[model samples]
Target chain A: MTRHYNFCAGPAALPTAVLERAREEMLDYHGRGLSVMEMSHRSPEFVAIAEQAEADLRELLAIPENYKVLFLQGGASLQFSMVPMNLLGQGGTANFLYTGIWGKKALAEAKQLGFAVHMAGSSEASGHTEVPTQAELALSSDAAYLHYTANETIGGLEFDYIPDVSVPLVCDYSSSILAEPLDVSRFGVIYAGAQKNIGPAGLTLVLVRDDLLDQRCQRIPSLFDYQAVAEAGSMVNTPPTYAWYLAGLVFQWLKHDIGGLEAMATINARKAAKLYAAIDSSGLYSNPIALRNRSRMNVPFVLADERLDKPFLAEAEEAGLLNLKGHRSVGGMRASLYNAVPEAAVDTLIDFMADFEQRRG
Target chain B: MTRHYNFCAGPAALPTAVLERAREEMLDYHGRGLSVMEMSHRSPEFVAIAEQAEADLRELLAIPENYKVLFLQGGASLQFSMVPMNLLGQGGTANFLYTGIWGKKALAEAKQLGFAVHMAGSSEASGHTEVPTQAELALSSDAAYLHYTANETIGGLEFDYIPDVSVPLVCDYSSSILAEPLDVSRFGVIYAGAQKNIGPAGLTLVLVRDDLLDQRCQRIPSLFDYQAVAEAGSMVNTPPTYAWYLAGLVFQWLKHDIGGLEAMATINARKAAKLYAAIDSSGLYSNPIALRNRSRMNVPFVLADERLDKPFLAEAEEAGLLNLKGHRSVGGMRASLYNAVPEAAVDTLIDFMADFEQRRG
Candidate 1:
């Protein structure tokens, strides 16, 4: 089978090794005579799997003892309402920093839910090209928490540093978690939809400080109650077991084959630098985001001539570099270099970019 | 691989053909160079898959054009909250018929959410062994909706007939959907967790009448708002793509191999009858559920001696009949013959039961 380099921003590429292992185990998981997809979530076999997955993820994030990891459903979209419903009880409000599309979306949901959300800082004026500096933030004194998007896939902007604030920090790290080393203890809650760096869509991994789980508003949905879900070990209902198992395999792959997140950071840095360097040197292509805020995971670049965009995508598809067409919200080409995407794929993309530039120059 | 007859109530068995197709396409789906799991929900390729799945489901159920089908996350547990949140507008009360464990659970959530819920009918006095007759239902005239569990998986009881009610009817068809024929026009909404009859866990299918989608309560989460999700074509968030794909495969299998719901009903009926007959004739084993309301999908039976329960389960597992242990709440043994479970498996189970009874009699 011919392997293709897939750069889909979310529901994106998975490591070939993990995919192959999943395939081998699809018919009968660990000689259990049934697919993981067919196994009972309460079965000892599946319980072991769910436990190991949480443990590995906890280790990878170096999550503190005070933090509770809950595997949930409804993607990051649910978290938009849940975070506020679970945190901003009664009359409290949250401070939001809008850096890109996802942040704007989260803010919209919080507002829609009647949460008194305050925009502490925003770089929308710069077309979401940069994150606001610490000085630009005007956090509310009575705020419940500070919410931010660590990396914006659509706008290709990333936070280079964790904000230093006394308030509880909540982040939508959907596009950035497990891509690099980070201080897990710095935040009150870090939630990510598990489609980018994680194995699959449909599973949202939420890590919240234990103390924060008790603040659920009276009207919050039972499933969205952090304390109840955390106590149930994220098995409040039948989980996406197959996705959870695949994610466990990914965590294993990252630990063994790719080494830890620290080593992963170095490799990710190299891939981004090489690709960005190629874009910078080429007169035919350019990335719009500021250098300091450019996302290492998702890099969106525009063709010198917009007319060549369709042809460039077609040619790239032919060359087996798939899903390069950027998000419709951001019209250009995006090459997402998640941990599953190897440096070799990035080199191939760079070479292909150079060739396409020469042919269309 | 040694195939087993798994009797897990939820996260249950899937058609072997569906699992095989998933395995074959694990690395590259339809030669698209990526697994369906890795495909973007927005891509044309994935959109087609999602559309086809919904289309096939609509065809199988003979669902009217007036109904909107939603592919959602969070399973049926989340729906326990969502149903009331979406349907029970301010000060609205719903009539609930409690036939079994699931109905009780849904009722509990509705009450917890402060929905003015009235118990229209309950089989609690009968130990959840039967469904309430139409004459027994005392539905309130001003009730927003009448809610019922089509089949109670834990108690192995089923409503053989749809409740005759004036109010819009909502049914939890989790364990019974696609196993038989039903009039979709009679129900205002039908929600099911896919793990039982569909494909996998984490994907919930909601079929709501177009007219009912308008009744969104002020506090409903956006993901739980049926109208919002339907308008978005269930793309309000990233769906469980792999589960949806597998469910589509199951739909195809039901349509082609089993020759639609009518034929599936006949097969299911036969499987249930054979097992029930065996239990009735044997002095050593008996099904507690009344024959009239006995579930055609899940047949829970208990050994007369009770002391042999553990040995029976252990030996059955060794013989490749797995997960027959009943729910902790209703302990003995449950043989769940979902659509995926072949009639031969039921015959095998009966044979094992008879042999075990003879040996221990």
Candidate 2:
């Protein structure tokens, strides 16, 4: 099979090894005569898989004992409302720091859930080109939590420093999770959709400090209650078993073959640096985000000549690069370099960009 | 690899052919050089898979154009809260007919969602031995919708007759969906978790009438909003793609090899009849549910000599049959003859049961 470099934000590229493992085990998981998809979540085999996945993830992130790891469905989008519903308590508010599309959508969902949300910081006026400085944020004293998106996929912006706040810190780390090391104890909650850097689109990973779990209203649905799911080992309901299993495979692959997050961070930084340097040097391409705040995971750039946008994408596709188109909200091109992305793919992308630049120049 | 007949209640057995196909295509789906899990949901390749899956499902069920089929995550458990959150607008009451575990769980979730819910009828007095007769039901005329579980996996009960109600009828067909034929027009909505009769556990299927969708409360999260998901073609959020793809394969299998729901019903009936006859003929075994109300999909029975229970399960396991253990709530054995269960497996089960009974009689 011909290989293609996928630069899609996510449901993005996964390690070829993980996919091959899944293929080998798809028909008869560990000689159990059933696919992992066919195994009962309650079975010892699946329970072991779920537990190992959680353990490996905790080890990778250095998650403290006080934090619970949950594998949930409905993506991080569901977590937008779920965070407020579970943590905002009754008649409380959350302070939101808007960096890009995901943060804005999360706050919007929280607002609908009756939270008194305040935009503590925003870069909307600058087309989300920068993450606001600490001094620029206006966090509320009465806020139940401070919410932010760690990496903004659409705007190609990222926060370099964790916010030091009196209130609980909640972050949507969907785009950048597991691509680097994280201090799990620094936040009250860190939630990520699995598609980008984890495993698949359906499963979501939520790391929550146990203390924050008690804020659920009595009326919250059991499935949406983080406390309940955490207590039940994320099996309060039948989980997306196949997704969980695949995620477990990815976790194992990440730990054993791909190296731990510390090693992973080095490769990630190198890839991001190479691509960013290329964009910065090129006369034909420009990334709008402020340099210090630019994302190491997603690099969104515009062709110097806006009229060349369509042809640029067409040429990129022909070069076996796919999903380079930017989000509709931010028109241009976006190359999402998640953890599974190889440095070689980045080299190929850099080569393509250079060739395209020389021709366009 | 040695094959075993897996009898898991859910995340259950799939046809061997389906598993083989998934294994063969796991790494490179239809020559796309990407696992279905790694494909962008918006890509033409993935979209074609999604569209074809839906088309196959629509064809299998003979779903009307007015009824929108949605592929969602969070399982049917999420739908429990979602159903009431969307349909029970302005705090109106919804009627629930509780037969078993799933029905009770659904009711609990709906009630927690702030819906004024009434238990229209319940068979808890009989340990859910039978579905409540339509004549004995106490449905409310003011109910926004009447909800029922088509088949209860845990209690092994099933509603034999479709209730003729003036209100919109919603059935949780999680354990029995696609196991038999049905007129889609008879119900306002039908939902099923994709484990038992469908493909896997992570994906949930919802077939809803177009007109019943408008009652969504404005506060509903986009992921939980039936109208929003229906409008977006279940892509309102990132769906469980691999599970969805597997479900499509099962749908195609159902349409071609299994000869659709009508043919499925005949085979299922024969399988159920064979198992029921063995139970009835054996003096050492019995099923408590009334014959007419007994679930053709799940047959739960107990050994007359309770001491033989452990040996029965152990011997069955040795005989290559697995997960025949009944739900903890009801201590016995349950063989779930979902659509994927071949008649030959049922015959093997019946023969085993008879031989055990004869030796112990």
Candidate 3:
């Protein structure tokens, strides 16, 4: 049985090795009589698994001791509300740098939750094809936290450098997190849903600097109370156990097979460069984003002839390159080169794109 | 290769056939060249899987056409907050029948969210070993809704009859739903964390009558707003795709191998009766709850001598009867006989119990 290279933005491809190990242990994990899914969340076995996943994540990211790593449920979309609910206390202004659809959604959720939001900066004027430079950033005078998307999965834009700021910085690193080395101490909070680089779609990883945990709004839902959740060790609710286990395996794969985040970043950059070079050289395809801001994670490109988009995607699928469809907001194709997406897949995708352009040129 | 009877109260055992099927499809679901976990939630394939899971569940429970089923993230604990946030609008008085730990937690969350709560009835006075009789119920006239725990996982207590009520009735069926036939028309909403009787953890199933969808609090989190989630077809955010698929497979198993809820109810009765009979007839073991109020799902019992508890649990584990330890609060042994725990396992458990008692007594 051959495995296909999947290019979904989130809920994307996982390391083949992770899937194989999980499949082998589907019914009995580590000689335990029951599958991991059947184990109680509070059991010694599951507790150890959860703890190890967090520990490995902390090591891979080199997280500071001052930060608390929380394994939470609900996707990052829930964090959109949770961030404001837990941070924007009375008389605090929420600041947002809106770059793409995800940032816009986060800002909207904060606003909907009755927080006053200040738009610190925005790339909407450019049709979300670029990111605001450090010089362009504006901070609210009384901002509780400045929020930004590290990488826009839809628009294929990524921040080239961390912005230097006074207030606490909270980043939605959903797509780019684990693909590159990060300085955890620079940010007050870093959150990513598991579907991309981590594991499956249910679990969310949250890293909150210890100082940021106490400023929650009054009457906040207990589950969204970062301080309370941190206190309980992210076990206030029954966590997504299977996703947590899979995430641990992915971390192990990252640590042993792929070295660490630095190695991951090197490989990811190489894959992105090869694919983007193919797009740049071809007269039949184009990527719209600026070179400096192009995301190494999600690479979106369009066919020169719009009519060929369907045929390109269809033929790509036929070749076992799956889920190459871009987000609806952005038409054409997107190749999400997450950590699990091997360099060979990108090579194959590049070759396929070249062949397709030749056949349709 | 032998699989054990996993008696975990939550994250309990799943059918061996289901697990094997999942293993077979881990690398490629239906030759799609991707695991279900890797599929985009919005893809046609995933959309079909999600829709089919809901449809199968609706059919299995005979849920009314007017009821909308939402597949959500976060376990039942999150629902404790969401139920009130969505149902208890301004000036609303929430009523709760506090039976056990879960119900108490729900009430506490509702009050913490600034909603006034009325204790309609409670079994805490009886150490949660019995359910409140019909005459003891005291729902307020001005209450927004009356909520109850259909089954208490820790207490080993279950409501034998649905309460006759005037206010909208909400039931937390985390430990009981789909184990037997449920009259969906009788309740305004039924919410269950999938870990228990459904599928894996992290996926929550909420069945809300159409009319209750619109009465949400003004500042409800977008993900927690039932109306918006139902309208978006549970794709408001990325779902627990694998769990949803696993649940669909379980529904298929129930329909084909088990032959629907009526047949399930019959088998469950026999299992519960046999387990309870063994405990009662044994001189060394006894159940604390009133027989009429006992749960057919979770059977908690205490051995006469506390010193033998460790040995009993250790020997049980050696014999492949896993996760039979009682809840920490209960301080006894619990044998959860969810649908997946076969009768043969129960017989083995009873025989083991009898053997242990004869030797230790």
Candidate 4:
């Protein structure tokens, strides 16, 4: 079987090693005689797997002991609501830095819920190609927490520096959580949809500072209660067991094979640098984001000629490059370089781009 | 590797055939050269998979055209909140029939949300051993809808008859959804967690009558809005793609291998009946619920001497009957006989029970 170079954004590529390991244990997990999917979340075997995943993640990120790691469901989309519900419970306004589509979504969710929300900072003036600098940001005195998207999957924008704020800081880190080592203490809450880097689509990873666990909104669903979820160890209900198990496999792969977040970050930086260098040097390809603020995780590019989009995607697929088509909201092409996407894939992608442009330009 | 009989109630056993197929395709789905878990949810291949799963489910239940089938996450627990928020937009009391733990939780969620809610009927006086009968069931005149648990996983209680009510009817069919042929037209809304009879954890199935789409509570999270979720075809965010794919495989297995729910029901009924017979005829083992209301999907039994509970569970495990310990909330023993728990597994469980009782009763 020929595995192609995949660059799909969110539900993106996973490490081949992780997939192989999961396949090896699909039916019976370590001869337990039951599939991990079939095992009870409360079972000792599954609990071990869950605990190990969290431990590895905490070690990788240097998460403080005061933070509660929750393996949740509903993706980062749900966290958009939960962040406001949990953080703004004490009658304070929700504040956000709108960098791209994802940050806008998070703010939209809060706004939809009728929360008093403010866009403390926005790069909308830059057509979502750049993130607002810390000096340009503003937060209300009543702001309970500052929310931002560390990496926007759709727009290929990322924050180069964490925003320094007096209030609790919340981050939607879906596309870049494990791409580099993080200062976990800087954020009150950091949530990521697990489809990209953690493991699979169903499970979500949430790191909530213990102090922010309470003060949740009144009259919310029990499942939406962070304190309860943390107390129950993310088993407030039946969790996405198999997905969590797979995430554990991924964490193991990262810690042992890839040598943790520092090493992963180095590889990720190099891959993004090579891709950007190729794009900048090309006559037919151009990315809009400012260089310093450009996302290491996602690179969105437009063809020199709009007519070349379809041919480019089709040819790329023929050349064993899959899911290179950009999001429908944004036309052209995108290459998401998540942690699992190897340097070889980026190198291959660069080669393909060079070849495609020469023949088709 | 040997696969033992798994009787977990929520994240219960899956069909061996489905697991085998999933194991075979865990790395490369149909030679697409990417795991289903790795594919973008919006890709043509994944979309086709999502659509086929829904279509197969609709055909299996004979769901009418007016019903929209939603593949969601967060299990039935989250549905507790969504139900009230979606149905009570026009502002009416939520009515409920409380039979067991799951029903109580559903009612509690509505109550916690500070919605106008009423307990139309309850079997609490009977210690939840019997379900409230249709004759005794009542609905408030102001009720937007009447909700009930079709089957309670922990208590091993099930409704023998759907309550004939004037209001829109909502049922949490989590543990018992595909165990038998269901009349899709009977209820206004039906939802089930996928781990039991569907495929795996992390995916939820919701079938909503078309009329219930628009009138939703204001100021709710957009993700919580059924209208938005329905319109997006459950893809407002990246769905639990792998779990959904596995559920699709399960639906196909049900349609082609098991010859639909009617044939499945016959086998399921036989399996449950055989086990129940063994329990009732035994000196030590006894099920609390009335015979008619006892769950066909989950059978919770207790030993005559509570001291023997430990030995019963220990020996059962040694005999390769896994997850025999009952839910911690109601401790004793529970052997969940979901659709995936084959007749052979039941027979083996019964044989193990008899052997244990003969030696230790």
DockQ for every model, please: 0.76, 0.74, 0.84, 0.83
Off by over 4 Å in 4: none
Q: Rank the candidates by lDDT, best first.
A: 3, 4, 1, 2
lDDT by residue for model 4 over B1-361, one digit each (tens)?
Answer: 9899899886889888988999888888888889999999988899999999999999999999999999999999999999999999899999999998889899999999999889999999999999888889878888899999999899999999988999999999999998999988999999998989998899999999999998888888877778788899998988999999999999999999999999999999999999999999999899989988989999999999999988888887887899999888889999999988889999999998899888988
iRMSD (Å), candidate 2: 1.4
**CAPRI class of candidate 2:** medium
Model 2 TM-score relative to the real fold: 0.98
The most accurate candidate by lDDT is 3
iRMSD, all candidates: 1.1, 1.4, 0.9, 0.9
C-alpha positional error of residue B206 in candidate 4 after TM-score superposition, expressed in Å: 0.8
**Residue-wise C-alpha lDDT for candidate 1, range A221-243, written one tens digit per residue:** 78899999999998877889999
Colliding pairs, model 2: none
RMSD value for candidate 3: 1.0
Count of backbone collisions in candidate 4? 0
Q: Tens-digit lDDT track for model 4 on A1-361? A: 6688889997989999988888788889898898999999899999999899889888989999999999999999999898888887889999999988888889899998889999899999988877888899899889999999998888898899999999999999998999989999999999999988898899888999998877898878899999999999999899999998889888899999999999999999999999999999999999999988899998999998999999999899988889998889988899999988888999999999999999998
Worst 10 residues of 1 chain A by lDDT: A86-95
lDDT of 2 by residue, A1-361 (tens): 6567889898999888888888888877897777788778888999999899888998888899999999999999999989988986755678899887789999988888767889999988777887888888898767888999999988889998999888889999999999888988889999999998889888999999998888986777788899889989999888988888888888898899988998899999999999999999989988988888989999999887888888889998898787899987778899999988889989999999899878875
B122-227: candidate 3 lDDT, tens digit per residue: 9988988888999999988788889999999988899988999888899999999999988999999899999988899989999999998888889988999999
TM-score of each: 0.99, 0.98, 0.99, 0.99
DockQ of 2: 0.74
Higher lDDT: candidate 1 or 2?
1
